[model samples]
Target: MLIGEVARHSGVSPRMLRHYDALGLVRPTGRTVGGYREYSAEDVRRIFHVESLRSLGLSLKQIGRALENPSFTPSALVGDLIRWTEDRLARERELLGRLRAIDASAPAGWQDVLRIVELMQGLNSASPARRLQTVLARPEGVSVPVGLLADAVLAESDPNVAGALRWALARSGGDGVAALAAGVHAEDVDIRRRAVLALAGMSEVPGVAAALADALGDPDPTVRGRAALALGRRGVTAAVPALVGMVVEGSSDVDAAEVLGTLSQDPGCAVRITTALVDELAAPAADSATRIRLTQALVELPVTSVLEVLRQLAHDDDPAVALVASAWVGVLDERSAEDRGDEDS
Candidate 1:
């Protein structure tokens, strides 16, 4: 076969085949009387082999080594090729993500596109301070892509950066809620914690409440506690059990008590919250310290039923608890007496 015929059959262009010959990747085995390059069967086979290697992303130099150097083992070269391919793939993926983020922003012009790209790059900076500064310095009234913020929020380990990201997401509202919600289900507990924290800041958004409801059952106590705190404040009765658990565990017990008090302001949930507190107090697992926290939580509830429970607890076995319950009940009793006397007068 001649050069043209070889090019036609092998799908390697004539120019590329000539370059291959020049590089000694493949050379014609003979020439005709006119001195045109001619390829024997072995030469054509070599051309196909070169094309095959090129298809696998081998450079011309690498192909030369592969074909001519007996010392060139496929193992090392293939390993190098694999690493190179992987790096290229990672770069492509990153570029694709940036393009998608830009598209999702629906940029109005080249300036908007550049701005979003810059913000994304800064958010992904290696330095935590840079990421936080990027979030804090976000342009006002210019739309920051919420998905980018959501991703930064989940991946951010620095507390300051995480808070700024959450603040940014809160202002951006519903745009990032979907991504934030997905982060809530991530296998990494830290990610789940970050997701819930971000959502907790944005719980006023339409779907965020529902997402938080799902996070109430998170396996991580920190994750569950944050979710429960957010949900309880929203007056979701489903959070009652977890909030009660927080009181017993003394993790943010004060805040949990305050939220429970707010929830109990509803006549409907008052009895339920009261019953939960009493049950924790009665549980054998409720150690002295646990019972003390639970007792303190009772002061936040204004319901009349808590008075009776406090009275019973006033004379309990733990003198410290008894003193706390008795003093608290006495204070409530005195306040009630004052009100009754004023009404009678």
Candidate 2:
């Protein structure tokens, strides 16, 4: 057929036919005596195949490869195509499941649900960490919807889940950290304590510091002590104020004393903070046993400032406080001299 006739029958424009001919994508089988282009039945079939492949998103190069070899199985090509489609559909189904869960929830307590939906959207767009971080930021005691919790639990099992969660947590805001911090108030003290410890290890959200600070006041001595230790582990200067308050308040409770001792050993803690703690322990109002425990903590740090703090404590009215402080000061002095010698060498 002539070019115009071929265009009409094939549903391709005349201009496109010419362009395909120029690119050698499609060519005439023969020419008339007057030089008019002629397309054979086989050429028409090839044109249909080309159009079909193009509609399926195959590039011209891919179509050429397929057509060049008639021995290539259509079933093989179609199987490959179906596999790609199925993979994409699976991901879409996961996203839809998350969305459906969110839509079914009431607004009054749907923050976690909404967050889950947002995370699913992120994953649909190939982001998973942003979702995990959102989960980590809820306030202590606030329970995320069961669905949202399940999503996080499932994410933990995914190989890529950790990387995404870490990235998102690193960039999380105060509100997000607060949510996770609130987990400290959960009725399940063990769960709450574990959550608090996890949050403390996270360097991403600054809000964890505030949460830890508040946890020190928990009615449960164990919770309060854990919070103090978490702050100390984090080593943020901001926590120094809270730690000092805990030391001076002198929890009569053994757990509280243990927590105070842990905070005293924090590497990030400054000399001045330790000194104030020592002074508090030496006060006439202070308990001699607590002073002894505080002295042990000062010994653990072994810094010059800590030694100085201990020296001040050596004058305590309690003979045991003075004796323990003096012993620790001698050990600290020896350690400091050795450290200086190493530096000099």
Candidate 3:
């Protein structure tokens, strides 16, 4: 085959084939009468081999070594090629993700596209400060993509940065709730915690509320407690049992008590929460510490029944419980006296 014919048959451009020959990766083995390059069958076969190696992402230099070095085993070269291909694939995947985020944002101009890209890069930066600034510094009218924020929120390890990202997601509204919900179901406890944290900070979207409600029963106690706390603050009475448990258990019991007080503003919730607390108080396993916490929780409830419960608790066998409950009784007495004074006036 002549040069042009070989180029035509092998789909190698004539100029590239010449370059390949100049590099000695592939060379025609014969010359025609006109001194035009001519390829023997062996040379054509070598060209095919070179093209095949090139297709596997081998640099031309590497291909030359592979073809010429009899001692060069393919195992090492193949391993290197795998690593290179994986790196290229990773870069391509990252670029594709960035493009998708930009597309999702529906940027109207190149400047908008570039701004979104910069925000994404900053969020993914190695520096926690950069990530936090990326979220906190987003200019007005330049909306950060929620998917990118979702990814960052799930993966962020730095506490300050994570808090900032959660804040940004909350301001983004319900856009990332589904993504955060998926994180709630992640096998990683940390990721589940982060997801719950982000969901808790988010505005009250129905889906986010539902996700939080489901999380109230998470196998992880931390997850359960956090979810219950968030739901309770939002007045979801489903968290009543867990919130009461937190109070009796003395874990975030202060906040738990406050939320319970808010929940008790409704008469029905008051009865349910009071019943739950009373049940904990009367448990045979209730210890002195548990009894004290339970006693303290009653002070947060303004229901008239609180006085009777405290009066009954004020006589408990545990001196600590008696002391705390008796103190609360006096506190309640002062309020009743003040009310009478107001009424008399």
Candidate 4:
């Protein structure tokens, strides 16, 4: 077959066939009287082989080696090709994600498109300061796409940047609640923690309570703690056990105690919260420190509700716990006296 006939039958262009010949990748072995290049059957088969390797993302140089070198192994090269294709696919997916975010923003013009692109680039920047500045410097009233903020907040590692992103999400009127909710179940502990932290601030948003409720079972105590605290603030009774556990475990015990205190404002919830704490205190596993922490938490409850527990604790065997409980009993007595005196007046 001549070059044109080879091109016609094999779909390889004449110019590319000539280029392949010049590179010694697939040189035609025959020539006519007019001295035009002619390809033998084997040469045409080599051309197909080169095209096949190119389809697998092999460079021309690599293809030449693959075809010519007897020692060349396809296994390692195929593995490398798989990785390179994966990397290319990942880049394409990321670029597609950026485009979707930009499109989701519904930019009105080229300028808006530029601004959104710039914001995304800044959020992804290597410098934490740049990421922080990007979030902070967003022009007022230019609503960033909620999805963009959601993605940023989930992946952000720097404390300050994460806080800013959460604040921005909050100000977006809870638009990113679903994304943050999904992050609550993320495999990464840090992402789960960040998601709950962001959700904690958006309790007023619909579905946030449910998301936090789901987070109450998170294996990470920090995620569960934040979720419990958020739910406790919302007066969700389901948070009682976690909040009480927080107090007993000394994980954000102060904040947990404060929320428990707030939840105790309800007469029924007050009984439940107080009973849970007392149960933990009475558990055999309760150590001195645990007892002491539980005792301090009791101080946050209503004096009337916890007075009996404190009085009993005041006479407890542990001297440190007894001292703390004794002091709280006296403080409650004084407060009760002050109230009684005012009522009498």
Candidate 5:
């Protein structure tokens, strides 16, 4: 076959075939009387082989080594190609995410597009301070897409950056609630915790309460505690059990106790919260420390609501428990006395 026939059959262009020949990739075996290049069957087969290697992303130099170097093993080269392809795919995925974020922002012009791009880059900066500064420095009236903020807050590991990202998300009202809700169910324990924390600050948002409610059952105690505390403050009685658990477990007991005390302001929820605390205090497994923490938590409740429980606990088996409970009872009685005195005067 001549060069043109070889090109027609192999789908390799004539110029490329000539280039291959020049590179000693597939030199034709003979030439006609007019001195045109002619290819033997063997030469045509080598052309197909070169094309096959190119399809596998082999550079011409690599192909040359593959075809001509008897000592060359394909394992290392193939591994390199795999890694290179993987890197390219990762870059493409990142670019796609950026483009989606920009489109979601609904940029009005090239400037808006550029600004969103810059903001996204800052949010994803390697330095935690840079990410935090990016979130804090966002100018007023420049609305970042809430989804972008949700993604950043969910993935953020740095404490400061995560806090700033949550603040940014809260400023968007309920917009990021769905994304954060999805993060609440994420398999990554850290992500679920972050999502709950972010949602905790957005309790006023429409869907936030429900998401936090769902997070109350999260496997991570931190997630459950944050969710329970947020809901407790929102007057949701559903958080009663978890809040009592937090107090019993001595995890964030102070904040949990404070929120529970606030929740007890609702007459109906007050009964349930008090009962849950009393139940935990009465549990057979309640150690002295657990009883003490539960006793302390009772101080947040309305004195009238928990006075009976406190009276019973004041003489409890554990000296530490009795001491703490008696102290709180005295404080409550003194306040009650003061209220009555003021009324009379």
Candidate 6:
């Protein structure tokens, strides 16, 4: 095939193909007298393999080395990559540790100052924005001192770094460490929201779980909804009863269907929770699309109770819900047959 044909088939641009050719990454199989490159099926396969390796975080140079060496073991290469990732994570943890120590100092009103320092450190990397994002992902309370330092870094860092820091902090689940939880219960809605999310990430922390459970009653539905998601994501079985209530009580402004769908995937969640989800699907006011989504989520659950619930939805008044439920029932029927066959053999 010609370059355009290869580009169309592979979803890689012709310019990138030429670059790869120049780097001896995926050379054309032949050339015309006039010099146009021609790629064979084998060459296309090689290009696909190169793309796959790149997706696995291999550098072009590293991939070239692996491809050139017939004896190269993919398992060894993956092990080496894992080691590299581990080392990088260790270094980031160390840097975060230093930032936390800085934040713990007795400096008066040093929140902004500490964040500025952390942001400055983040910008020193090749992808400053991405590095700053990594710093912000540190779980709350687990790294309270780190969160404070990130706050301090954000306060005085370069405007670009500060922006990245803010985005990261927004996603940070400030739950685990005591230092992070200090101001979490503040009267401010935004503060409570951020704190609740951070705490949610700290599900193992007793106080974090308490905070999320309490936030379920917040006047702001958005906060309550997010808290519901946080609890579900944490797989807090303790919160399943409350989440079931949220689904039925209808106080939650957030998509109760979606939250219930999430809870269905929790291995520790009870059959009663899933039963509540099925009941919601039966509601006349429920959107047909949401009902379909709930049915699909139920199908993914391993609990046998899901089979009965799906059967009930398979006859739902909404055609979409019935269709989705019917499809899942067929899949389950097929899986059950296979399991029986395996046992017999």
* Candidate No. with top lDDT: 4
Q: Output the better candidate (2/6) by lDDT.
A: 6
Q: What is the lDDT of residue 246 in candidate 2?
A: 57
lDDT of 4: 0.93
Query: Could you tell me the lDDT of residue 335 within candidate 6?
Result: 93
Model 5 steric clash total = 0
lDDT tens digits by residue: candidate 1, 72-174:
7798878988999999999998888789889989988999999998998898899998888888877678787777778888889999988888887887769
**Could you report the Cα RMSD, in angstroms, for every candidate shown?**
4.1, 18.3, 5.8, 3.5, 4.2, 23.0
- What is the TM-score of candidate 3? 0.71
lDDT of each: 0.88, 0.63, 0.89, 0.93, 0.90, 0.66
State the local distance difference test value for candidate 3.
Answer: 0.89
Model 6, residue 130: C-alpha shift (Å) = 14
For candidate 2, write residues 1-345 as lDDT tens digits: 988899999999988878778878889898888998899998888899899998876677777778888787777777877898799899898768666657644445567666545645554344455544455555575433444343343234344554444344444333346446657667767656555554655664667777777776666755665677666665545545555555455543343334444554555444556666666665677677767766665565536447666787788677998898888778777888898899999
Q: What is the full ranking by lDDT, best candidate first?
A: 4, 5, 3, 1, 6, 2
Least accurate stretch of 10 residues (summed lDDT) in model 3? 298-307
Question: What are the runs in model 5 whose C-alpha is more than 4 Å off?
Answer: 1-88, 139-141, 340-345
lDDT of 4 at 124: 97
**Candidate 5 lDDT tens digits, 199-232:** 9898588988999989988878999999998898
**TM-score winner, 2 or 5:** 5
Q: Which digits, one per residue and each the tens of the lDDT, describe model 3 over residues 1-345? A: 899999999999999999998998888898889999999999999999999998999999999998999998999989988998999999999899889899989999999898888888898899998888888887887888888889889999999999888888888878899899999999999999999989988867769889998888788878888999999988899999889988877888988999999999998888887888888999999988888888899889974858889998889888999999999999899998999899999
Q: List candidate 1 segments past 4 Å from native.
A: 1-90
Q: Which 10-residue window of candidate 1 scores lowest in summed lDDT?
A: 138-147
